[model samples]
Target: MNTRTLIASALALGFLAACSKPEPVVEAPRPVVVFTLASAQVAPAALYTGEVRARYESDLAFRIGGKIVERRVDVGAVVKPGQLLARLDPADAGLNAEAARAQLAAAENEFAYARAEVLRYRDLVAKNFVSRSVLDAKETAFRSATARVEQARAQASVAGRQAGYTSLLADQPGVITAVGAEVGQVVKDSAVVMKLARDGEREVLIAVPESRIGELKKAGRVEVRLWTQPDVALAGRVREIAPSADAATRTYAVRVSIVDPLPALQLGMTANVVLADAAASAGGLLVPITAVFEHGGASAVWVMQAEGELVKPVLRKVTVRQYREDGALISAGLTAGETIAAAGVNKIIAGQALRPVAPARPAAAPMAVRPGAAS
Candidate 1:
């Protein structure tokens, strides 16, 4: 009884132990798209909409306010220096000029009388016929009269200038782009009467976002093209950059001065500005668009690490400078020669061990054998 029982218990225990040990768990390596990090010549190109404008634009305004009596030219009229653009009533200015002339004449007569009085005072003092104090009094009177005459002369000069200011004349050769006043319109002093685009260097004005302003400033080259003529690419340089961003648009105004502008390049035409910068293209790591994913509201990607013969995926937080159709420009949080997951990011698991296998090649077609040629 003892031998049979022992033998049966031993066999049963062995069978149970074998069944409890689960078959070695085996998992197939998950396939993911991986990209090796490498330095690439990234030509950064940014497109901005711009308007062609005169480099030196002037807003012609009236120095003296008056009722606009007539306008000589319409918008877009070319004018030479000293050409009359418009005029005021002029009757008031003419009256002022005449009054100034009358004052001048009166001052001259007073000056002549002062000179005669001074001569008489000098002669009386020399002859001792009049007391010294009497001569001194006449001399003081003559000096006071002379000061008044000089003041009157200055007043007349200014009045004469104001009379001429009633006529709005072009200070330089230019094309009129705007007229702010019509006939019978009363304008304030220094108010803009006409907008003029001086004939000279042309420029393209663009609004650049705050994010790209730094890159724009550091750009090595700039190019411009008109919307009508795409092939007419012209070279340009940064002529002006706004010191501060616009409060409304939060963009900086940029002016690109054209070099050797063509005669056909006119003001008010739409232009395209392209900035080519080497700052982003010189030294940075670029990954595929799919490689980046959002983590904790920050940018991150799965980096592949070589673990002996196997590959392991580790999460890396990255600072993304810019994103384009091709990929994202990584400003920080990555190093050269790093491998990152290019696709299938959602299927990834933390600390997952993986085997890096090259993408499988297309299977070679089986060679067809001649019918019954060989066994």
Candidate 2:
């Protein structure tokens, strides 16, 4: 092998290698579920079930304890002022009044006798037939008898008032909503015998859960609608909210005052209450839950950016306002109309080429096949 021959062989080998080129390396783009960012449609208000009630409902009870002898009113009965609703047994009250009157009469007779004796004693004292001490004793007896007469009169007045209480009279005009006592039933003093709902000013009562109590406090507008009259909506305001949650249901009781209630609204009617906030329902963007991934100890998503004819994944950090069952509410770091990888976000990397496929649809359920059907 001379120098010229070796150089000629190396040149021939290099020419052959240059003429036969190596196969080109082509990278296939990865398929990914894509999603577009857009403003989420939020509900204008939250709904709660409620019941219509009167603004003033009171329990009617007997002032004195006795067995009921008469019940003139029943549930749903309309009553007027001073109208008799019920009556207790008058035997006891009448007897007490009679006893008081008899005692008063006896006191008056004793007073008359004392007055006569005092006069006689005075005459005797003037004539020197009786001592001055005897006249003084007679005057004292007259004064004591007069005091007894006055005391008996007061007792008679109380007894008369008690007899009037035996008859239950309606203090106000209202409709009876409940009846707790009937004829022949014995009731104690102050025990509720009936329920009356005054015919004015209606309200809706609803229960709210503790989780959405903050939204209730910030409610901008409230609306109420009766179940029977769904088209007619009444303006309402939050009149009261329970300070604490209920022990059994663990919900707060809310009362809404209807501004101008219609005639159709009756007691115990079912209704619906809605709470709305215009400010809070705007400017939120939702993305698929799978699109969000943790990147560098922060929440991020793989945003798709067009690189000429190919789409590339770009890691972008975003501020997640809330994570919902359907998606994550993105408050920042993403603009409307932008596209992102909806699934397989963990496998995505910056500058990675992507195919940008539409989101995968949920799999259809298999059709039921009966025995001895098609093979």
User: How many clashes (backbone atoms < 3 Å, residues ≥3 apart in a chain or on different chains) does model 2 have?
Assistant: 0
Best by lDDT: 2
Predicted structure with the largest TM-score when compared to the true one:
1
Clashing pairs in 2: none
lDDT by residue (tens digit), candidate 2, 1-375: 899999999999999999997999998888888877643333434468888887889999988889999999888898998999999998898889999999999999999999999999999999999899999999999999999999999999888888898998888888999999989999998999999998778888898888678877876558898889987888988888899999999999988899988877788999988675332244346677788988889999988998766689888999876664345766678877788888888888788878878755842111111223221
Model 1 clash pairs are none
Q: Candidate 1 — what's its lDDT?
A: 0.80
Q: In order, what lDDT does every prediction score? A: 0.80, 0.81
Candidate 1 regions exceeding 4 Å error are 1-44, 277-375
